[model samples]
Target chain A: MEFWVNRDCFYKAISDVSRAVSAKTSIPILTGIQIIATEEKLTLVGSNSDIFIESNIPMTINNEKILDIFEPGSVIISAKYLIEIVKKLPNDVHVKMNGRQLVTIKSDDIITTLNGFQADDYPKLPRIDEDASVRLSNTELKELINQTTFAVSKNENKPVLTGVYLSFQEKQLTLAATNSHRLAIRKLFIEAYLDGACIVPGTSLNELSKLMQDESGHIHIYITESYITFKSVNMTLYSRLIEGNYPNVLGLLPKDAKTVITIKTSQLLKGIDRASLFAYEGKNNRINIEIEDGSKMRISSNSSEVGKIEELQNIKEINGQRDLNIAFDGRFLMDALKAIKEEEIQLSFGGSMRPVLIEPIGNPNYLHLISPVRTY
Target chain B: MEFWVNRDCFYKAISDVSRAVSAKTSIPILTGIQIIATEEKLTLVGSNSDIFIESNIPMTINNEKILDIFEPGSVIISAKYLIEIVKKLPNDVHVKMNGRQLVTIKSDDIITTLNGFQADDYPKLPRIDEDASVRLSNTELKELINQTTFAVSKNENKPVLTGVYLSFQEKQLTLAATNSHRLAIRKLFIEAYLDGACIVPGTSLNELSKLMQDESGHIHIYITESYITFKSVNMTLYSRLIEGNYPNVLGLLPKDAKTVITIKTSQLLKGIDRASLFAYEGKNNRINIEIEDGSKMRISSNSSEVGKIEELQNIKEINGQRDLNIAFDGRFLMDALKAIKEEEIQLSFGGSMRPVLIEPIGNPNYLHLISPVRTY
Candidate 1:
């Protein structure tokens, strides 16, 4: 495309889309970013097979001139080279389409010509009806994504398990993810009605979280049978939904347990961290947790090569007299503890070998379950 | 060792010595840190084949009890595990030698017993004649190492090129290193006696620079045929010297040149960096530089796949009217520029195809020479 744009404006736009560019993609054109310069704005698009990111820079932003479109055209350039060139350009750059696929960029003292592919070779973005969409604040969506995405299975053997399941009914939206070893669930209230469940890849949720820099603004999400699009100001991200049915995980959480203890989240996190030194040397990083008189808990781990460590954490509230001692993966417990935002957390144990339930104090909407390891 | 030390004191001492511990050594004892507990002091030693670092934590410092030595004993424990355990310990730790080699460390609520190796298995520290040692300020030594070490050859093909050559005569000390392509020479005045030239590996110099954090006082250095010892307050670092004779590079720098140019170091560095982006696509990151009218300079680079970049820099002075253009590796130039602490630098060019001389504006004690590359 023929256009003259400020160095920083073009740089920002190119970087936002470059996140989706993968050099190892099977499709050659997918590695290139598409640039379409109209009389009013310039749109940059980059896509891999699973996710696509597009950003637009208008000719006028806040009544300030950002670009001058000499001619309306489109071209596709290597995302890697485009970013490096734009960042290293001395001043404002003038970009022009040379031959059929050659793009020339000229700055104050530097002139560079890069090979470009035909814009038509790039894949088309998914289209969905804008009217059938749900709205949620960036803060709420980012929080929900962070709380559950880490627990998603990284293996692609079971496609649905690699994605986070989202279900919305009335004003409540629930997100859950599990990798069989651990499960995380979170719920929040929204203003729109979303009744259907969709499986979104954990990677896409991570990218969306990074793009949501502002917390207060609302993000519009349009969902189709196969794809979902999240649109914000000047940017749109499209992600393909995994095709399959998600497993039911509600039965994994405990409804009643023999012992329940509430302890300060930070205090218990530090204790587990100390014990992890010895646990990390063990076969499975297994650490034992013992609750005594319901109000006292001791964490211990040991290895033959390294030494042993036992830390006693104080519990403020206890429900039953039954004592329970169980061993679980220290990493999973650390992750769950970090996700808890409240001052105190309640841990419910069904048995020595059963899945343990961890949740923020007085909050049942967010629950974390970890399967204990057989240490014996 | 049997001792009771404050958590912070023990942690700091162990961390310093662990830097010298080698996990890939053929000798298994080299992976462990030797701890010798005396009635007055506790010493920690860690070593690889090339370097050894020892730090002492005394029982009393400034009339304050930092370490309490219950008995006199010695043992060697895995450096990796010991560091991790001491770092995570809650408060004061009580360390005791159980049998001959087994050790137990007890903190407030944690008790750990680790298997240890016999202290006799560890190699003894090298002995040097301290009477013939020379003293230099830590700041001066650190500066000299930084100014010349980066130019040392990283390839082990020629072992001597990997070390920095140090020569002392009367009170002047000259340090030089070259990788055949570029050379860095630095000279300083030290109050020392006659000492033959010594070759110290660049890797050892780099590590020594980091270990010499105390810049207030002088450090005593004892150099031998096989090893060099650097002694500070309660720390001693011993490094094996590389065995070989360094090449003579005193005549590589041009004493007289047809053209001389003075430019701001920062501006030239930035120009070269920008031009290198395109040049990097070529076989060797080669960038061209042209000086015009003794006051202006231009830098440019281009690749067929990527574009081209040209930057113009203003110079303060030029001694000759002859215009000279040359091409060189951008990475080498960047490294030399970063080593130069002066604001302005003087460059002397002998011809279009010869090495260029770069030195600080008024300082003749330090010089850097870079060979030019043929662009055609």
Candidate 2:
């Protein structure tokens, strides 16, 4: 393979794909990035068992030539060394490969020769059908991922709960995740009516979110037999689908509400944060909270080894007449509070032992449920 | 005991002193920060076995009031908890200590009661004589620390090698550190005529450098029998002196050079950095450099497992007729290159097997000596 490409574009493509590469993979070849140079473009791919990311550099960008291909071929070089070398090289970069799979990377002043594997030895990406795909905005998809993934179970015992459940019907797409102790659900409307459901690892969604953080425009989501791909203009991300049934998260909600309190999101978030600092050091990061109808709320956590903290903040509004007191994992409450994008949120309680529902005061599209810690 | 202080000033003081506190200390009380409120100022102190830092917040700054002390007393609270609480508190903070050592930390909205120990239980900082102290600019003192400390040996086999040696005579205060393979020496003039020498741990110098990163003005260096103190306005750092005879490093250098090369500091630094990236993965991070009279320099490193790198750059000037080829640790070269203040540097080699001297051209204040690796 012999090719020359703009250093900045190549650097960006390599860095973006490098996120999918893991240095500790069991498969040795998987730790390297595959570089393919065709007559029209250069494709850079990095992958592990869980994820594969590909970024393409077109031959020319806006009339300026970014790539000049002398020979159309491919090679796989160690991602760790390739990235470090490419980061330091200056100006336009030229690459050439020898018969022994020794690739020499050169810039204006530095020449780095790296040992690479033959392209034929690399693992090929599975075929994905573009017809069975739904297009959605990057912003809306990012919201869905962020709102629910934190509730995904970290315990490996239940593999399905470690992934986010996506349910699409008609024009509404719903995403839900639960860890038995807490559940988060978000619903959004999309123009694409392709109805489908799949469970994707929460880790994949997080990586996808980061990929789209600087990206705008639309992203096409394609679900195949065993994999799902999020493709954009010049970048594509493929993640393995968890082959198990997701829990019925909607059925886990409490039926009714005994009392509801409305408070500013910042106040509650800050209060819970301070309380959890001391609470998290204890057994379960537990905090006791009490609220009455149209009155100030009290949040407190005590640790025998550490000290105790009591924070008081006024309530914006409250419903129901009965005063209520409950104990919960403050960390769970804080996570839900942070996920909320609104300035104010409402807290709805079923009972001392039942799950509490937290929702933004005006937005009906998102909600979180937390099971109260049972205290004797 | 009770006091009210401005949150920003108090926070800065605590943050500065907290650098000396270690959470993993053997003595439990050492993990806490001692706060002593006097009629005129509030003193915060944190210490580990190696270092102690104290910062004092006066009652007033310029013309504005920063502190109001209702009573004079002292308490020691967990640095971890105290820092977190103080970071989140808003506006001014009010601190009150009860007879039971249960301190109430309060702001307008948040209240935290932390368990504390008697201030007398906290380890006391060793006193250094102020009369036998040298005054130096923060910038110069910081430069001396940065230039010489990197050569200190990380291995604790010889405890003295882990510390930087200081020699004071006449108006010049010389700092030297060597790890057998490499040595860095820096000398500068100070106003105070305190003729004494002491060895301070490289770790302590690094911490001291960070403390002065944003600070300006002069700092006082006090040398007593057992301790060395670097004190500026409102802040004081105390470090235990290492007691041992340093190796005679001057006797290790050769009298004359067989060949010499002059090159841009940045160019040589960058070349070594790129070579070291591939070299570091191998056994000794070894790189071979060759130079003759008025010829371009070539820097190369090869690894059988990885590949090889050859970087060539034009030479500005050269002296001596004989050609020289030498191998040295690239990391050591990079560290000395980074410490150099001049754009042009002179590299003088005595022979292929002798120590190489690197010094900034036209500057007699600092120089680095690196022993060449003898490869068969």
Candidate 3:
């Protein structure tokens, strides 16, 4: 196969697909990326046993030709090597494959050759049917993944909790993730008929989120018993689902709270951050927040080994008696606050030992709950 | 002791000194930075037994008042914790030390307290006589360190090779370093009366280089039998000298070469970069460069498991014979090329296995030599 392709376009597609290629794989051929050129498009695919990503370069985009193909064929070259060569090469790269599968890449006066394997040795992507797919804006999907993925349990003992639990019903999509200590929930509404729940591995969701950044096109999602596929523009991502049931987390959030306070997001975030400097070095990264009067709250953390930090921030509103104190892991609190996209946040607490609910001021679309640490 | 210092200025001073503090140390006091405030200036010092860096913030700079000192005292606080607190605190930070050595730092509504050690527990910096010192521009001193420090041997088995060797006589300063495989040498002429040679640890020179990046003032260097001190307007850096004789590398460089090739610095650098892609994965990272007929050179590298690359770059000038092929480690070539601050470089090769010398086209102050690999 021989072709002259736009260097930037080819480099971008190769990079996107290479994210799925694992450096360590049981199957030798899985470390390589498969490149195929058909009559209309050129496709590059990379996969490990867990996930696969494919990106296509259309022969013509926006009425302008991007690739001039002399012959249509396929080859599988080492992804690690191909990316380095392409990234360093100048623009308007020319690539050709001989009958012996020797791939040559040339730009300016620089030439690189790599021995590639037969395309037949590379694994093919599982066929996904378009009729069983639902369409949603890429922005909505990205938001749902980011809002909950950070809360997934890192412990491998519970396989289902290691993935973001995604549930779809009627026209509403709900995403939730919890690590037993903290939980995040987000919902988006789309006009589609889909009913099912799938647990996508946290790593897959993170990679998908990064790939979909600045991408505003519609994403067509297809789910099967074993795998889920997300297709947008000329890229398709397939991730294997965890074979188990996600924990029921809706019951973990309480409907009633004894005290509630609304405070500036940035001010409270900075307070917790300063407390974390000392708390992080101790056995427990615990920071306590005490409600002082109606318009002020004191956040303090003490480490007998390090030192202590006490910060006071003014509250926008409060609806409860004073003298309420609660403690939480600094990391969990920081993560929840960082994901919020609002200036003011309302935190509701049932008691010193109960789970605290945090949500954006006027938005009901996202909520984060954390079980407070009991400090005696 | 009490003081209200500019947060940004204090933070910058702390960061510079903290670079000398080692987290893993046998002496507990060395892990902390010693802070001393006198009637005129406040000093911050960090030490790891081998090197000590001290920075002073004077009460006035450029005829403008910088600090208002209320009392004079000293205390030692954990360097790692102090840096974190100062960096995150708001502007106009107020610090005070109580009778029990409890240090309080406050900014706005944020308050942080740290238990500090008595200043008497901290080690004192070695005294060096300024009568025998030499003065040079900060830029000149920094350049001398950067140009030769990277070639220092990382292996500590030979303690002297781990430091850059400095020789001074007749108003001339010469710096040299080598890993036994490659060597870099630099020379500078300054107006000073000094005579002696000493070896300063490579790590110390690197940190000193970073600290002096924006300093344009003069640096007075004081050297004793075992220690060297670098003093500037408001900062002093003390480093212990390696207690062994440096290897003599003067005889390793030949006076004549059989072949010479003059080429653009960037073009040749890029050529080797591409060749390094395949060469680095191999056992020796060996890449062969051949001088073609007239003013053209072919740079190539081959890996039996990976592939091969051949790049041809135009040479600006050629001296002596053609068809001379030599092989060297790609990394060494890249490092040598990167250190040359010139548009063009001239490389001289004596033979296939001999040490090849690289120097800038017009500048002779710096030279680098790399031993070629004997490929059978």
Candidate 4:
């Protein structure tokens, strides 16, 4: 496309879309970013089979000229090479598309002509019905994704478990992810009414979280049976939905706890991390947690080859008269504590061999469950 | 060893010595650090085949207690694991020799026992005559290493070229390194007597540079036929010297030049970096430099698949009435420019195909020679 654009604006658009571009893709065209320059805006799209990211640079931003479109056309250029070229170009760059898919980008005294693919060879972005959309603030969505995405299964054997199960019911949205070893669940309130369930790839949700920078504005999400689209001010990301039913993880969490303890999140996290140093040398980084007199807790881990560590951390509040000793992966506990923003956290222990429910103090909306390890 | 040391002192000592520890070493004892606790100081030594680093933590520093030695003993503990343990340990730790080869490290409520290697199994530090020693500031030594070490050949075919040639004469110390394609030479005036030439491995020199830190105190260096040792306040690093004679690089530099150009080092570096982005797409990342009218220069590079870039850079002065155009590796030029601390750099061109000499504007001590690529 023949266009002149500011270096910063063009570079940002290319970088955002290039995230979806795969250099080792079997399909050659998938390695390139499709650029469409129109009279109103210039759109860049990049995609692999799983997800697609498209960013638009408007002709005018804040009443300032960003792009000058001399001719409305489209072309697909190598994502890697184009990004490098734009980053190295000095100041404003003028791009012109010649015949035979030859694109010329010129800066101060530098002119580079890169071979590009035909626009027709690139895959088309899916068309989603905007009417079926839900509006949520970027901040809320990012928080939701961060709190649960890490627990999603990375193994592709059970493809459905690799995606986060997002369920919506009358102004409330629940996000849940699990890899059998650990599970994370978070719920947030939204303004729109969206009563449906969709499975979004954890990878795509993580990328969406990074792209959603504006905290005040609401991001519009449109979901179909096979695809989902998240649209922001000048960005649109489309990702394919995993086709399968997510496992029911609601029952995995303990309903009745034998003992409950409330402790400072930072103190507990540091104790577990130190104990894990020795435990990690063993087969599994398993750390034992013993609650005494409801208000005192001791964390200990040991390895046959390495040494052992025992740390005593104070708890603020305790419930139930029974004492509990549970063993769980130290990494899971650390992740749960890190995700929690509150000063205090409540940990519910069912038994020594059962899953432990970790929740922010006085907040049940966000919960993490870790399966206890059999240290014996 | 039996001692109680502050966490900070223990952590620093472990980290400094751990640089020499290699997990993949064939020598099992080399994977651990030798800790010798004395009544006055605690010494930690770690070494692989190429180099050894030792850091000593004194019993007291600045009227503060850093180490309290209850018993004088020596033991070798896994450097990698010990460093991690000491860093994460809570508060001051008490380390002791529990048995013949068993070491116990205890913190507040954490206790870890690791199998320690016998002191007899560890290799002894090399002993060099202190009579033949040269003294130079740690800052100067570090600068010399950074300026020339990157040019050393990494190939083992010519093992001698993999080391930096260091020569001390009168009050001048010179360092030179070359990979056959390019050469880097740096020199500084010292307050020491004359010494013969020595070849220290570039890898070892790089490690020593990092350990030098921001200190300006003079470092004592001892050179022998087989090994070289650098001693600072409380640290000592010993490295094996490479055997063989170094090439005569002085004759390679042209005494007389037909063209000389003086330009801002940073401006030229930035221009070349941008041009290399396109040139890098080619086989050699070759960038062409042309000097016109002794005051203006043009830098350009082009790839058949990618585009081209050209920048007109301003030069302050040019000597001789000859226009020269030459092509060389952009990365090498960038390295030379980074090593130069002067604002302006002087480039002497012998011919279109001859090696170009890059030196400081008025200083002749440090010189870099880059071979030109013949373009058909």
Candidate 5:
């Protein structure tokens, strides 16, 4: 294989695909990225056992000759060293491998040669069924992952909880994640529909969210029985589906809230943050929210060792019945608040005994529920 | 004590004083900051046995009322908790501490009460002698610390080597540091002078450099028998002097050169950085520089396990009459280059076995010496 590619373009492709490459893998070759050079494009693939990412660089982009392919071939090179080398190269990189285990990379006067593995040793990519492909704008895809991924269980005792549950029916897709303590659910209307539900690892969704931030194109998702693939113009991500039945969480949603409090999101977030500091130093990181006559709100936390903090803010709007007091894990509350990108939010409390339903003032598609802590 | 201070000013003083405060201390009170409120100013002091930092918030600055003293008193508050509270407070912070050991900090509608300790338990400040004082601009002080500190020996086997040797003689203050492998020396002319030399801890100098970056006033350095104090208008830092006789490093300076090469500092730094990648993977992180025919230079590193990299750049200018090949630690070379902050640098070589002298082309106040690695 012999090819000369633009330094920056090659670096981006390598880095994008390397998001899936982990140095600590059971299989040695899994730590390397496979590089395939063809007459039309160069392909870079990286994978651990759970995630696979591929990025492609064409020979010409926007009428600019970005790649010169003297020969077409393939090699698997160590991702760690190759990335470091390519990131620091000052000019276009020239790569050559002629039926040998050594791949030579030359840029300007700097030449680096790394030991490569045979491409035949790489694992085969999973076959993605093309029959039921769903297309969503990058923004919608990002929102689906960000709003729900944070609520996924960090504990692996129940593997299904460690992944985000995706359900599609009736031209709408719903994403939910819960760690038994709190839950986040978001729904968006889609042009097409899928038949069933699947669970994708929260970590993969996290990586996808960050990568998609810079992606402007729409994403096409295709799923097989065991693997799910998200494809864009130049990038592809495939994640192994968690093999388990997700717990039925729709029943856990509150039917309605008795007391609803609407307040500025920033003000509430800052108040909770200060209160949580003291709560964290003391007992179970619990902050209590008190609503009085559905007119005013107070957020307070008491810590015997450190200090105690109490913040009172005037409510923008209030509705429903008598007073209600509820306590929640401070960190969980902060997570839900940060995930929200709105100015004002509504908190619907269920008499301080049931979970609090949180939603943006205007957007009804996103909802976060936090179970109140029992202080008894 | 009862006082109302500007929230931003209070936070700044708390953070600056908290730099010397470490939670992991044998004496628990040492982990807290002593807050002394008087009609004149509010003083915050933190100590960790080795370093002490004091910052003051005056009653008014530039006709603006920044502090209002209600009752004059003092208390010791935990630095960890106080910093967090002050950082998140919304408006002017009003601090009130009566005869009780509880300190109440109120801002906006948020009230926080933290447990405090008696101010008597806080350590006393070091008394700096008033005999000979040296004053340096913040920029000069920063340069003095930045240029030589990196070469200080991290190994404590030679305790004196862990500090920078400061010698004041002939209206000049010379600083020197060496790890036995490399040495960095810098000299600057001062208006005043001291008779003797002392050793200051490298870590202390590092912290002081970072803190002084934002300080606009001149720094007056006062030295006692066992302490060195750096005092500005609003901030004062006192560090315990390392008690020992510094080794003689002047003899390590290269007397002359047989081959000299002038190159762009950034270009040379990048070449060495790329070469170091392979060198770090090999033995001893050794990089070789070859000056062939005094017209071109080659920087290269070879690792049998990983690969090898060679970068050749044209030398802008060359001096001396002989060809030379020398090897040095790539990290040491990079450190010297990074510290120079110069466009072009001159490297003077003494054959292939002796130390190389590196200095910025236009500046002579700084000099770096690196011992050649024996590649046999």
Candidate 6:
């Protein structure tokens, strides 16, 4: 089999699929990327048992020929070394396979011969039926993943919490992630009415988000009993659904808050950012916020060995109780503020020891709840 | 003590001196930067026993007052934390000392109080006599440091080889560094006649290089019995000389060459960089080069488990012997090529087993020598 491909096109295809390549897998074949050249297109596949990514380069794109195929064949090459060779080679790369295992790549005055494995050694990707499929815009899919994935538990001890829980009900898609200490939830309207929840691993969502383009397009999601597949233009990503039930985090949020205040988002973010320096030395990375005179907010932290920081930030409006103090992990507040897109934010406190709710002003699409630390 | 200083000026001063701060030193005070406030200027000092860095910020620059000193005193604060606080604080920083140890830093609505140590606990910097000194332009000094430092031995088994050797004689300054396998030498004119040599640790020279500005100014270098001091505009850097006799490398350079070739420096660098990909899997990262037909040079490498790569690079000129083969560490060649600033470089090979010499076509200020490896 022999084919010549543009260096830039081939490099991009390899780089996109390499995100799923596992360099230290026990199965040696998993460390290689499967490459197949057919009459229609050239495809590259990378997988590590948890997620599989496949990217295709069409024979022609935008009326420009990108790949020309003279023969149809497949071979699995070491993803790590092939990328290094392709990156160093000049503009056009000529690839040919002698027998089933030896692949030769040449460009300019340089030539490289790579020992490859038979394509039969690669594991077959699972095929999920499109019986329960849903379609969403690429922008909505990207936004849903970004707003809630940060709250997923990094500790694998609780497998269910390590994934983001997705629920579709009444033409609305609800995404929720929680690590027990903090929870984030976002909702967006969809066209489907499927009523069920599935847990997709946080790492899978993150990789899928990177593969997707920000431009307007439709993403078709197909679900099976074991895996979920997201298909977009020239790419298909498959992730294994976590096996277990995700806990209901809706009950953890506070029903009513005694003190609520509206403040500039950037001002509060800067104040907390400064307070975090000293709070890092504290036992729980805790920073305290207190309402003052019904028109001002104070953020403060202290460490006996390091120093103390106090920042008084002005507020636009405050209601109900005044001078109510609450303390929580500074990192939790920073993460919530980063995901919030509004210029103004509203912070509500139930009490000193209760969970605090943060939301973008006048926006009902996002919510973040953090459990306060008890500081006596 | 009480003073108000611009945040940017203080930050830059701290950053320069903080390079010498040692976090895991047996002497606790070494981790803290000593700050002294006098009537005219504020000074910050950091030391790690082997090296000392001091930066001064004057109260008035060109009739513009940068600092307002209300009281005069001294204190030592943790370099790690002080930098973090200063970086986050706003505009002008207000600093005050209470009694002997507690320090308060304030800016805008934020206040930070830090526990510091009495200035008396900090070690005093040694006073170097300027009886024997030499001066050189900043460009020459910087160039001299950059050309030789990379060749210094990183292994400390033989401590002397880990330092750059400097010889001053006949109004010329000679700087040489070698790891035993490769050597780099550079010479520039200086303004003194002290005929002696000293070995300065490569790590210290690297840090001193970062602190030196690229502008044109005279650098006053003072040498004492044990230390060498480089005094630039507002900074003084002191480094202890490595005590040992440096072996004479002048006798190792070949007197004549069997084959010589002149080629573009960038082309040779790129060829070696590409050859490095396959060479990494080989023993010692070895790549072979052989002149063919008196004009073409072949760079090739092979790994039994991976693959083989061959590259033919065209040369501008080849003199003497027609066909000769030599192999060496690709990394060594790359380093030497990077340090050479000439567009056209000449490579001279004495024999298959003899050392090879590389020099710029028209420049006599720099020379690099590398020993070839025996493959048989």
- Estimate the Cα RMSD of every predicted model relative to the unseen true structure: 2.2, 1.4, 1.7, 2.0, 1.5, 1.8
Report how far off residue A35 is in candidate 2 (Å): 1.0
Interface root-mean-square deviation, each candidate: 2.5, 1.1, 1.0, 2.2, 1.0, 0.9
Q: Candidate 4, which CAPRI tier? A: medium
lDDT of 6 at A293: 69
Residue-level lDDT for A363 in candidate 5: 93
Report the Cα lDDT for residue A227, model 5. Answer: 93
Write the number of the candidate with greater TM-score, choosing between 5 and 6: 5
Model 3 compared with the native: what TM-score? 0.97
Measured with DockQ on alpha carbons, how good is candidate 2? Answer: 0.79
Q: Which ten residues in a row have the lowest lDDT in candidate 4 chain A?
A: A209-218
lDDT of candidate 2 over A83-132, digit per residue (tens):
99888886899999999999999988678899998889887886789787
lDDT of 4 by residue, B72-126 (tens): 9999998877887888887998998966788888888777777888898888899
Error of 2 at B218 (Å): 1.4
- DockQ of every candidate: 0.58, 0.79, 0.79, 0.61, 0.83, 0.83
Name the lDDT value of residue A97 in candidate 6.
Answer: 96
- How far in Å is the alpha carbon of B225 misplaced in model 4? 2.5
Of 3 and 5, the candidate ranking higher by TM-score: 5
How would you encode candidate 6's per-residue C-alpha lDDT over B230-288 as one tens digit per residue? 98878989999999999897777788998999999999898888888888887778889
What TM-score does candidate 4 get on C-alpha atoms? 0.96
Clashing pairs in 6: none
Candidate 3 CAPRI category? medium
Q: What lDDT does the true structure give each of the candidates?
A: 0.86, 0.89, 0.89, 0.87, 0.90, 0.90
Give the chain A TM-score for each candidate: 0.96, 0.97, 0.97, 0.97, 0.97, 0.97
Second chain only: TM-score per model? 0.96, 0.98, 0.97, 0.97, 0.97, 0.97
